[model samples]
Target: MLEYAPAPESRSVVQIAPSYGLFIDGDFTPGKDVFKTINPASEEVLSEVALGSPEDVDRAVAAARRAFETWSARPGSERAKYLFRIARIIQERSRELAVLESLDNGKPIKESRDVDLPLVAAHFFYYAGWADKLPYAGFGPSPRPLGVAGQVIPWNFPLLMLAWKIAPALAAGNTVVLKPAETTPLSALFFADICRQAELPPGVVNIVTGAGDTGRYLVEHPDVDKVAFTGSTEVGRQIARSVAGTGKRLTLELGGKAANIVFDDAPIDQAVEGIVNGIFFNQGHVCCAGSRLLVQESIAEQLLASLKRRMSTLRVGDPLDKNTDVGAINSAAQLARITELSEIGTEEGAERWSPECSLPDRGFWFAPTIFTGVTQAHRIAREEIFGPVLSVLTFRTPDEAIEKANNTPYGLSAGIWSEKGSRILAVADKLRAGVVWANTFNKFDPTSPFGGYKESGYGREGGRHGLEAYLA
Candidate 1:
């Protein structure tokens, strides 16, 4: 048996100032208010960040508007060079960014290092190639830039989400004023530095750090020509209402409650690993997390036993620890929501179980949990928990699994686990999700588009479709 060791990643490589300000135009300016962003792993205040006001949002939009004239008129080939530069810089600084992400976002170091940072760099690289290729992208003969993009991203996968919004926006030739989530603003501030390092044109990209109201002001600003948001469905609805009749182009990548369906003929061991990755990865903060596990009734007992054995081996603790498979919950409020939904699941008659896992006392932590005997009507099954909690349900047939999987209001993503290629295709086609995976869950790529249907929000956020939203 392979022995494990504590190999904590060093945090000294990354530096965070005591306080930060709004990155407007090309400078970091003071704000009227400031709020502390804390490390969710230890509840330690990492730094004080600016809380942007309506006036600040106005200034940012104005700066972007001014820059947009020169920025948009620049040749697409020239813009591609800048994008390529930024991508290279990101790759160079990846280790620093990865450690910082683990600190600020409370995800395991392995995830931040391996999954998030790589994808962030990949997104920029992918979009950079598209900068000079828009005419060939089928968006009419000469697609034009939308003046200024107002973007808001969620706390989960902060840097990657920023890349998703900013990369395509810049590739399509739009300037941006983005508001990072209040709890996880440090990475965005660092990204502002990345823009400066790339010598990106002033006001071509801006970062405003604050809570919900700050996002509202940025998205609602009249000078803003495009709005892109990735967060909860509730907030997406509000943004939709605010942008209605405002003549602003809008795209939302909202909430999800994806299903991972496992058939009797499937590889049980591989399915178990995928199930673990689906809901437990990043503490289930993923919007497209496969929170609902639908297993065939025939293999329920066998699969459950194997899953429990694997769950028992998961190492949960510090985010920087290389051995940690799961880390802290992003915040106390998020932990509370996870707890509430879990308790409600028990009250509603689902059997709840969790492997024995020790958690640090100072952090917001929830041990990886699973609820068996879950029904479609259970709140845990219906709503997005956004935590390391999985709800398991059994289905006798493929059609029954399909019915239960589509029972939720979310249609962001789904997964099919079957050895049969025909069965995978049939099930994936029947699923009402925007993205589907066969024998895998929670996989993403820059070349492929991703978004959702129904209440999960409208419009795509990757590939050529992502660039289209930032263009005329």
Candidate 2:
């Protein structure tokens, strides 16, 4: 059993206000309905965040609409300067941002600082260069902004997701009214403060905090020219249905149950590490998490034993700790989903194993679990169990691996591990996922385009491809 130690609370490095309000027109405005954001790791009420209603959505949309006229008309170089300033400010305040994100989102402080915040800044810096180079991006005669963009981001990677939505929208000359998830709205509220610090123009970016209702209002609002959402497949489908007749541009980055395939010829140790990273990173709250494991029949038993031993040693605990590997589950609702799916795995006859780790009594937590002897038809294999759970299956040949990998409705990401160059290329070419990692998993960069296929939803989020949803 992994030893339990009470994780230390966030150090008083930066002083934050007791509550946060909606950020509109370069200022914070209080909303009518206030909601409390809890720290998922400790079940501690972090802060009260104002929830924006339909009326608030309308007000934010108006603010965005007002900003668009002048903001979009400004020279690309001027916009680039603002982006540069924001990037610098983000770097300056990265430590505070990291601590706040870990407190609010249940991800480890290391990941928030090393992975999320750095990428957030890199995204802004990368997109800033594209602001003045849109004409060269092969977008025909004159690529123009689509006016006001309504973006709804998930709680998984709160501030990073916000950056993914806002950076591209603003770079393409569109103003934004963004809605952060209710459970993790604090970092975004703090982000609005950063924008003010950067002297970003009024109304260029507005933040509205609320739950699903606010997201629905933003999407259905007639004045919203574009909609970008990162959430569940069900919600993505609903948004698609809602936006069908409106003619509004829409981009959805939804769910995934990615397949991480290991061939007989692959380097066993490296493949094992990749397997560990594929499913367990960020407690597997990632949309592109490699939840399915397809090992070649020749090495199936060996790989399973290796993976189980590795999973046994994973240090699952508080998010604030730098040494913590798997942190707390995002919420109680997510914990229920993970529990239900894990039970289903056992009911379906797959052998389940979780480390004997002691969890804090006050918070939502789940042990890193692995299910062996899983068939493709199993619920744990087909459904996206967005927690630290791995479903392992065996495949006889390359054809079988490809067949099993693409059998799901989701096509967000896939992983291929093989020593042979030809085999890696062949398998990668056949996978239907938007992002394929050959001999690696969960690799991200600001220049790489990421999205999904089929039920996983559509549109890309990074690189030049990300600009499509924001342009006419």
Candidate 3:
């Protein structure tokens, strides 16, 4: 077999500090304790990060509160300019940020460079334009900013998720205290420098880094007026209970087990490609990844063959390698979860398969995988694996496909692969998911709204809808 020669993005683009501190009140401050964040691709210790304590959260919220008074008092146009400046700075420093993201997050550098960085900048640019036009955003004639937003983002898409929550909240004139996921804290910390360069007001944005307890401290802090989270549904439930009557506006983008339904009439080649992109992109760490494949029985065999062939071709190696298609799993714990779930799939009588691909020995890794003969009753088909694993099930009719697709509690995102426009429209409307795509998978834009239904959580992010959550 012909092999791809190593073509790695230079690591020199990013400069990692030996130790990091919490960004509170527009400055880096010492924390009570600290932890190390490692590069998952090489298992190399990237940097030491402060483990934020409740006191740290306190300072962050207090800073946000103090800044909120003046921040909320700023003219919408002034806030827009700040957001615009931040957006421009992100573009200028994107290469550094992208390299840092790949090192810390274990995602392929190409994704961080091409998809994640561009969208991160676009989101800021999108919300910046909305800063001065909140009254016309359909929220109300004179919408108001909810003060001191507390945001918790997941490790899957660190910088992009930060942009999703912070851009809108800041644009709506609310200051923020954000806790980036413990595994991916470097990029957010680097973003603190971008804020300094933009000369944003002190306390306008604060980043506290730590594990679950620190996140709990930030979200449960009384000073927070709004709470936004993107992570597992289990934690979303806990946040809902904590904020039950706190009067804090909340939005949660949780887990998903989306179905990519490919009909018999669908183009075989395109459907195979979409299936790969849907489930394997970002190693399937996405919240709205199409983990479930619902294919018509008539074309099931053909689709499986094509999908296996394509999956075999996916390169899994060094994240910095430009030719690598898939990279390392984010962490050892996440890899264990994927491994356990995949083992259970085999024990439960589902046929498991993976392409003949060798993985790196030094760090966490998993080959692209799929489960055939899967039924909805199987746990692998029902639960969110959150890895590069796909569960394939067959259906005879469009109604059957929709039935299987909407059967789960998750309603985050789904896709259809039929060329027929009428069938696509009808099936999409009935799938009970927040976002549906036809003939494509894993596409995102700043102008479009994205969210989920049912246990996948509530409220929308992106476009005009995103501004509503931050505005009162």
The most accurate candidate by lDDT is 3
Q: What global local distance difference test value does model 1 have?
A: 0.93
RMSD of each: 0.8, 1.5, 0.7
Candidate 2's error at 419, in angstroms?
0.7
For each candidate, what TM-score against the reference? Answer: 0.99, 0.98, 0.99
True lDDT of residue 223, candidate 1: 88
lDDT to native, each model: 0.93, 0.91, 0.95
- Ranked by lDDT, top first: 3, 1, 2
With candidate 2 superimposed using the best TM-score fit, by how many Å does residue 226's alpha carbon deviate from the native?
A: 0.4
**How well is each residue in 1-472 modelled by candidate 1, as lDDT tens digits?**
3568889999999988999999999999999999998999999999999899998998888899999999989998899999999999999999999999999999999999999989999999999999999998888999999899999999999999999999999998999999999999999999999999999999999898889999999888888889999999999999999999989999999999999999999999999999999999999999999999999999999999999999999999999999999998999999999999999999999999999877888989999999998988899999999999999999998999999989989999999999999999999989999999899988889999999989999899888888889878
Give me candidate 3's TM-score against the actual structure. 0.99
Candidate 1 regions exceeding 4 Å error are 1-3
User: What local lDDT does model 1 show for residue 113?
Assistant: 93
Q: Give the TM-score of candidate 2.
A: 0.98
Candidate 2, residue 72: the lDDT equals 96
Report clashes for each candidate as comma-separated counts: 0, 0, 0
Model 1: per-residue Cα lDDT at residue 439? 93
